[model samples]
Target: MSVWPAYAEIRFADYGEDFDPSVERTEMERGVPKQRLLNTDVLQTIEASVQFRSAQAVEDFERWYFIDVKRIGWFSMEHPRTGEPINARFRNGRIGRLQPLNTLFRFAKRDLVIEYVRAPQ
Candidate 1:
């Protein structure tokens, strides 16, 4: 599997953290609603933005994104919360375009909604 580019600085923003549960709720006749899990193997999603500082870092990220993940469409990176390695794909199978952090173009950032492909070890 393709690994996240080390050059990409994961300056995560203060957004929602933790995996969202995939559940199916059932309406009961006389009792509380029952919830059933839809996924047992795949875990929660990791959504965050990564920052790229420096010209070379941006170039490296472009290559990795277009070449490595273009076809396979998935990559492995450290879980933002757990710090353990996990397999994940672009959130909704797509990544948003990068934006310059400032006018100078010395920094860049992109939003990523990464869905876990499997349970983390």
Candidate 2:
């Protein structure tokens, strides 16, 4: 498989209500600070804790990125503890850092936002 960009952003449509201050900080800090989250070109998978609307959106995202979800498998999982579906990025290139399920603030809508932290490097 051709290596793609290491980092990408995924937004879960239904995070609803509960918001994490830390995530908000990271999301907002994408390109502002010297060390920005957007500067995350070394990671392989960036998982967004959230809920998605339909499987079609997931498939679409995979197609857009040229990634095979079936091969990629469950990029993210439905949180067992929380019951919300989790969307994530995986394979290829970066650090292994994940937010705790509890730490994940919910988004409103229905789709999950995920980012690939690293690409085949």
lDDT of 2: 0.36
Residue-pair clashes per prediction, in order, are 1, 28
Instruction: Give the Cα error of residue 10 in candidate 2, in Å.
Output: 5.7
The deviation in Å at residue 70 for candidate 1 is: 1.2
Report lDDT (CA) for all predictions.
Answer: 0.73, 0.36
lDDT of 1 by residue, 1-121 (tens): 8998887766656334556566789999999999988876645666677888876787788788788888348788887776888777776556667789887668988776777755534
Residue 53 shift from truth in candidate 2, angstroms: 0.7
lDDT of 2 by residue, 1-121 (tens): 3332222233443233222222123334456633224342443223344332444433444463445454343354444335555454444422233333322222222133334333222
